[model samples]
Target: MSVLETFQLAIKNILSSKMRTFLTMLGIIIGVCAVIVIVGLGNGMQGYIEDSFADMGTDSLTVMIMGRGSSRSVSEEDMYELVEENSEYLKQISPTVTMMGSVKIGSDTLTATSITGISEDYFSMKGYEVVQGRGLQYMDMTDRKKVCVVGQYLNMAYFGGNAVGQTLKINGNTFTIVGVMAQEGSELEEGGTDDCVFVPYSTAARLSYTGTISSYAITVQNTDQISEAKAVVEQKLYQVFSDDDAYTVTSMAELVEEMNSMVNMIIYILAGIAAISLVVGGIGIMNIMLVSVTERTREIGIRKALGAKESAIMRQFVIEAATTSSLGGVLGILLGYGLSALATSVIANVMPDTPITVSPSLLAVVVAFGVSTGIGVVFGYLPAKKAANLNPIDALRYD
Candidate 1:
């Protein structure tokens, strides 16, 4: 028979044994489905991580001063001058001091509200907007003013959304509210992003009773040159303390890249584990094809007696097996998509804060289909060879 005729006959034969063909394709279906779903989940997790990092602002760096085995210390002015000297890369610098105490408003003590001291540029550097009143100015820092800004959560909860010009006490020290920040989260809840307070860095240092500022937040002029800015800061700190352990400079962009790499590594490992099912499915195809050859031995003998070549017989079996596997792959792809959509819906409903969408890429679908078809060819070889080598003798009466 010609190649097209052989392929048609193979399809007819496969269709004649519906249950058996389906059973043979079941393994491939499961294997492909598993691989696609796992890859989609990995992609969703990676996307969520990137978004979380974006909220934290990847164009900035944080420096922590910890003088271990050294008596040297870097001053806040030194950090500012470092940014000024390296104006080619660095842009703004803010000394951050987190106060440890609950906020007091009259007789009520708001424990969920955090208090932090920051410079005037910190607001612009972090891209935070003040909707009511005005933000911190250079005068506030220089004069050690007891002025503060409240987040939307605290404002709405305590001051009925009219928190600007109101006063809240932190660490028993009264601070007048100069501005109210725009809402940071969708919902105003306790201990959420919009449940904090900000004061002048100099005022915070005095209230917290700390003469030395050990933490600093620095923003880069160009995000693409974050590494260069980080190196310059690190080099300046090293020159001051002469010890790498004295101070640590960390870039938010670098942290995001490291986290992404770790997530990808974990996903690759899980995908590898899920891929073992494909090998098992290939073995199943081989076993079923071998049984098929045995069951069709008589038919093969009749065809050979009618002058069919061994190559034609082999090609016919291989093509039928390939078609079976390809059909399974198609079904698996459809199922994977359905499951991915369902997972996305369920995640969005359950964890509204972190809505991770399961999205399978076209590349993954194509690879899965290609691998399934390739397995069919590789595993079907032995059975096809057996069928092609069947004896055509014995007069056909032994049946």
Candidate 2:
């Protein structure tokens, strides 16, 4: 018989035993779906994290000091000296001092409010735009102005509306609200441009008895110069701290790279788990194919009696197994895509900055796994061979 005729017969047999064929295909379908969904989730999470970092500005670097054995703190003078030394390479350097305090507007008081002392560079470095009024200016820092910028939540919590040009007291010290920041998404709620109140660093220094800046934020001239700028800042910081290990200098790109590495490791681990499903599916195909060979023993003997070649019989059985796997693979791909889309939409709603991405390579791997499972006829070989070798006369005579 022609190859096409053999394929037709194989398909007909599978259609005749639709329930068994479907059960056999179930394994491949599940395996493919697992791989696609898991890998796509990994890709989406990575994309989401990276985008959040990008939204915070990639050209920024943070510097914090670690002191000697007895004390662990950064001096205000050390931060000022570092900034003065790196003025050429740095675009803007700001000293930041943060604390959680209560804000009071008239009789209303909101607790657990974020208050930070920052320089003029804080706005641009953190990608914050002034929605009302204006940001802190150089004069504000130098003059130690008792004015501050408030986040959107604080505005609503304290003043019940736009807090710009209003007066809010922090820890018993009243400050005029000169600016209000635009609403940044939830990603910023953790640690970004939003969800904080900003006062001049010098003013915060006067208010706090610590007399030290917590950290410094430095913006580079360009992203390409971030590495050089980090090195330069570190060198400058070392002159003051001298111990070299006392301070930590980190750039946004380096942080993102580390985060990506962590994400990739997670993806690999999940992918490994998903791969096991494919093996299980392949075994199911093998088991079903073996049963098919046993049930078709008499039919196989008749075919051989009609001069059907062993290779033809083997090819027909293999095609049947492959078709089952291939059909499952296609269904799995469709299901995987739908699952990815649904997950991405839910994640996007929660984290506007994080975009979920479906990886094409993951899809390819799923399809390949399905095809490999179909080719598991190698495992079904012993049964096919036994059936082909059966004597036609005996098969015909047997009940």
Candidate 3:
């Protein structure tokens, strides 16, 4: 028989037993869907992390000076000199000091707030906005004024309106609220602008009884010059700390690269796990094909007796198996993409800033479809060979 005739025969046979054909293809459907959904979620998470870093500004760098187990200790004065010397490379710099303390408003005491002491340039360097009142003035830091800026959460909780000019007690000391910050959602794992209470570095230094600041936020003149600026900052910091471990400087780009690598590793691992389903599906295909050959024994005998070559019998069965598996693969791809889109939409509602992206490349779909078809050829071969080699006389006499 011709190839077209064999294909028609295969289709007729499959259609004659619709329920059995569907059951045989079920495993392939599930396997393909599993792979697509797992890979899609991994890609979405990677995109969200990259976007978060981009919003924080790639031109910015953060510097931290260790206070213990170091050969040298960096002071606030060293940070000032570094900024002045590298004025061409540096745009804005601020030494930040932070500590946890209690805030008192009349009879209520909120003790879980983080108090951050910062210089006048801190707000601009960190991309913070003052929705009401104003940011810290130079005089506030220079004179160690007992004034502070409250976050949006505090303003909404205690004052219920503009918190500017309101008096609040901090760590039992009376301090006047000079500014109310705009709501900036959390970017890092620790906390964000919404959870902070800003004060002048001088007052923070006095309260903490230490001249050493926690960290510094520095912005570069241009993003392209980040490498040169980082080198200059590292040299300047080294002069004060002497040991490399005493201080650390990091840029947003480096952070993004590290996070991307970690996420990619996780993606491959999950993809490998999903691949196991494909193997299981292949095994299932082979078992069903074997059963199909036994059930169609009498048909095979009649075909062989009527001048049908063994090759024709084999081709008919192989084509049927491949067609069945391919159909399941196509359906799986459609269903997988639909589920991924639905999952992304639900995740968006829970976290507005996080974006879940599905990969637009059809590579995964094409590869999976090809694999499913290949699986059918390999697993269908034994059963097809058995049918082709059957003895027509014995097959006819048995039934």
For candidate 1, list the clashing residue pairs, or say none.
Answer: none
TM-score ranking from best candidate downward: 1, 2, 3
lDDT for each residue of candidate 2 in 197-277, tens digit (9 for 90 to 100) = 889988988888655665888888878878988999788667656788888898988898889899889877876777677
Total backbone clashes of model 3?
0
Worst 10 residues of 2 by lDDT: 186-195
**lDDT for each residue of candidate 1 in 1-399, tens digit (9 for 90 to 100):** 887997788789879989988888888888888788888988898888888888878999999998654367778998899999999998999999998999998889988788899999999988899999999999999999999999999889889989988898887888899999999998999899999999999999988888689999999989999999999998888887888988888988998889888977987788778778777888888898898888888888899999989998899889877878888889888988989899999999999998798998888899999999998888888999999998888425435
Q: TM-score of each candidate? A: 0.96, 0.82, 0.81
Q: Best TM-score goes to which candidate?
A: 1
Name the TM-score of candidate 1. Answer: 0.96
Question: lDDT rank, highest first?
Answer: 1, 3, 2
RMSD to true structure for each model, in Å: 1.7, 4.0, 4.1
Candidate 1 structure lDDT: 0.88
Higher TM-score: candidate 2 or 3? Answer: 2
The residue ranges of model 2 lying beyond 4 angstroms of the native Cα positions read 1-3, 69-90, 160-162, 186-195, 221-229, 239-244, 341-399
Q: Which segments of model 1 are wrong by more than 4 Å?
A: 68-71, 394-398
Quote the positional error of residue 144 for candidate 1 in Å: 0.5
TM-score (C-alpha) between model 3 and the true structure:
0.81
Error of 2 at 222 (Å): 4.4
